[model samples]
Target chain A: MNPIRQDFPAFDGLARPLHFLDNAATSQICRPALEALVRFETDDRSNVKRGVYARAERASVAFDDARKAAMEFLNAPSPEEIVFTSGATLGLNTAAHILQERLQPGDVILVSLLEHHSNLVPWQLAAERRGASLRAIPVTDGGRLDLERLDELADRVRIVAVTHASNVTGAITDVARLRSFCDATGALLVLDGAQRAAHGPLDVQELGCDLYAFSGHKCFGPTGIGVLWGRYDLLDAAPPFLGGGEMIRRVSLERSTFAPPPHRYEAGTPPIGGAIALGAALEWSMAQDWDRLGAQERELAGRMLDGLASLPGCRIYGDTGTQQRIGVVSFELEDVHAHDVCQLLDSDHGVMLRGGHHCAQPLMERFDTVATVRASLAPYNDGADVDALLNGLEAVRRKLA
Target chain B: MNDALYDQAIIAEARSRTGAGRLDAPTVTAECDNPLCGDRITVDLAVQDGAISDLAHKTRGCLLTQASASLLARYAKGGDVAAAGELRAAIDAFLKGQEDERFAILTPVRNAKSRWDCVTLPFQALADALADLEKRG
Candidate 1:
């Protein structure tokens, strides 16, 4: 087994050697996160914010500690900046809702074609509600954002929200250029960090984004938990997204006052166990040697790219090189539908992959294809996983196409 | 696992491409997409006296979807306009584990739940065409 594979329980007892290449969808839970989840559920199970008894207090502390962990994981300025959300979808929605106050009529919400629908739809709704228009920074054939068009599209733009890294193409956005554009144009920057969070810890401060959103499930943690980190002043200024329980300072028959920053965003009882386990997952990621794991991932991704290229009629999307990209590789064999390839890969060879538009129909349109077979990699993935997919594709082509 | 899902019969059906192109002029045309996998299918029908006189389709989808479209063409060409809906319901019931020899080639697909939409896409387009024809007259 690969050394990193030992950390993932999904690899513990497999009927066959598992070739899990769909990390972009969700990474398997690490031992630390699973243990933390079980510990919270078994020992300190209680609703937070209202309960003051022993177990409840323990749960509250654990939840608070998890927030602090998330803050540290993002290199956020303060724990108050981290708001617990159900997932990145809810996080971006909250970000969009809060930022809706800033949008005026005739303003533009600048997004890119590389964004997953989670990042695009929220801004679109905000634009529609505020009587603002939506403009997109076009995608290059290489699948990277066309930053050259920023100056043209930056007019009257209030919020510039885009993916930190593409879920399908694995193309990392040039955030520094985008940040510069935001600074020059006086627009708020929001990053959908769902894909990048799976790679390693992030520095939202250094990235120069006003709001950052990421899902816990993609980062080796349980589902139903995620983080939305923003500057304290900005979060404090924006009105609460959801109105209930802990998010309010006081409730009356008529008007009610709201709580402070993080609490202002977290309504009703939050997913305490899921949040704590997400914190544990982040902490575990922090403890690892990312430089080493990243190098391994790059090599594996390179192998996948090269092997696919060797096969005739194989067309790959996004950057052909490993530079400025992660381990996610989307491609298709000529005359073969993506789902057919995926089905054969999984059923015959135990090689998992994702197919179809991957929630980025605009990008698919840009690529001029409806679907592609995607193989995403994580630190636990090894060369065997890549080879399994490469070998399986040949069989798929012979049998199907 | 390999032979079951993409059984030889299913593969041949998809490869057959029966009624694969769009009709030159059709009385009714309907288009639908598989929400799960983004498979798109367009069906053109020439209905006469509440029966299908001619049928053709353009499909951009997985093998299952292509095969399903082919099966629809083979089963319902020159049949009554209601055959599309009947076949759709039968396939739905078959996918839910009821026996129907017409759909036995698709038995392997029953275990793969995600592909259900792919297989049912063309039937939906045909039904949509029928509904549009009904609304027209």
Candidate 2:
């Protein structure tokens, strides 16, 4: 048994054994994070940054501490650079709206084909609203981004938004290379780290990207919370995303002034408890041996790919090469609808898999399929979970055949 | 074989491939696709004297969808085109766990809630084909 599996309460609470393979969508929240949430709600319950009482002060300190934790997690330059939002979708939308001021007519917003709808749609709406064009960085047949074509749109590219790791294909993008391109072409690289944030440490300064966004729920934290880390200069220059309480410096009859970058981006009373829980989640994640976990995930991914390949009439998608991918595997069984496969896997084998486009419909188009059955892994998954998935798929093959 | 959703009856019907062809100069044709699973079904009909003289189908889908299409084609031949529109309603009721003897062949898929669209794609295409025929007259 994997030692990490003991930390999650879902494994112990289940009536029957469950093979949870949908971690890429949303992971099971860890014990520390859940405890932090309950403790905060019970002990230090108050509106932050408003009341002068002791509980309110504690809430304010915890919220600020959570920001510092997020800043440290990303290895960002300063805590002032991290802004909390509803989730990654809102974070990307905020980035797009902030960058929209710089986008002139006929300028281009370059996004890759592997982006989730969160990363793709914001830029699309921004381009439409600002009279700019949106172009996709084409993907190769083996699911790698085609970087050779960067020069084709080099002149007019204003912003380059790409995913750090694809949810569907599990292919990890080379952001360092993408950063170098952005350095030469003067494009701001916005990385969607929703899928990659939990896999390993992320250093915004080391990656050399202008902005990064991620969700807390996908990283074993609470929902309704996310982080948007940007360069201080870029964030200070951009306008406030939402207008309300807690983001203003002064209000007058004629005009109003906004606060600094991080506070300006946070409009309303923030998710104080959620932020505290996410801080605990980040602390718990940082304590793990990521190098060992990464190796284990790669080994499990390789085993899953080999097993699926040996199955008759199974067509696995994306880069089967485990070197540049995470444990997310998307595949189709011959003559089996993805929904049917998922249903049978759950009902008979207690194996939970995701079926559909994985929220990347354009990427699905690139693969020439409507949907694929995806089984993703996390640190807690062990060989038993993989065996359950394999056995379920084999049973489906024999019964359907 | 334990707790398997796809029974031998449904598998046999799916693999039978009965009425699996295109009709020559068909009077009405309709196609539908379940985009989530990429299952497509096309229904072709030759209507003469207000009756379906011939019924055929082409499908790219799972065993459940193929079985449903085959069973529909087998039962729908020589039936009135106007009556084909009722097939969709009957399937709708059947999927809601209703007992309809006409749609009893779909009982194997009753518990598979997510796949309700699979068992009804062909009937939906037939309903559309009937509507198209009515528009022409």
Find the candidate with the highest DockQ and give its number.
1
Going through the candidates in order, state the TM-score of chain A alone for each one: 0.99, 0.98
Per-residue alpha-carbon lDDT of candidate 2 for residues A1-401, written as tens digits (9 for 90 to 100): 78887778787767788799999999989888898899889999899999899988998898888898899899999999999988899999998988889999999999988989999999999999999999999998878788888778687999999999989888999887888889888999999999999786689999998889999999989999999999999999988888988899998989789999899999988998999999888988888999999999999999999999999999998888889888899999987778778878988899999988887888988989878999999999989899999999999988774
| lDDT of every predicted structure (CA atoms) | 0.91, 0.88
Q: RMSD for all candidates, in order, please.
A: 1.1, 2.8
Which segments of model 2 are wrong by more than 4 Å?
A: A250-256, B1-4, B17-35, B43-57, B71-78, B108-112, B120-137
lDDT of 1 by residue, A9-92 (tens): 998888789899999998999999999999999999999867879999999999999998999999999999999999999999
- The CA lDDT at B9 in model 2 is 75
Error of 1 at A342 (Å): 0.6
Model 1, which residues run further than 4 Å from truth? Answer: B1-3
**Candidate 2 Cα RMSD after full superposition onto the native fold (Å):** 2.8
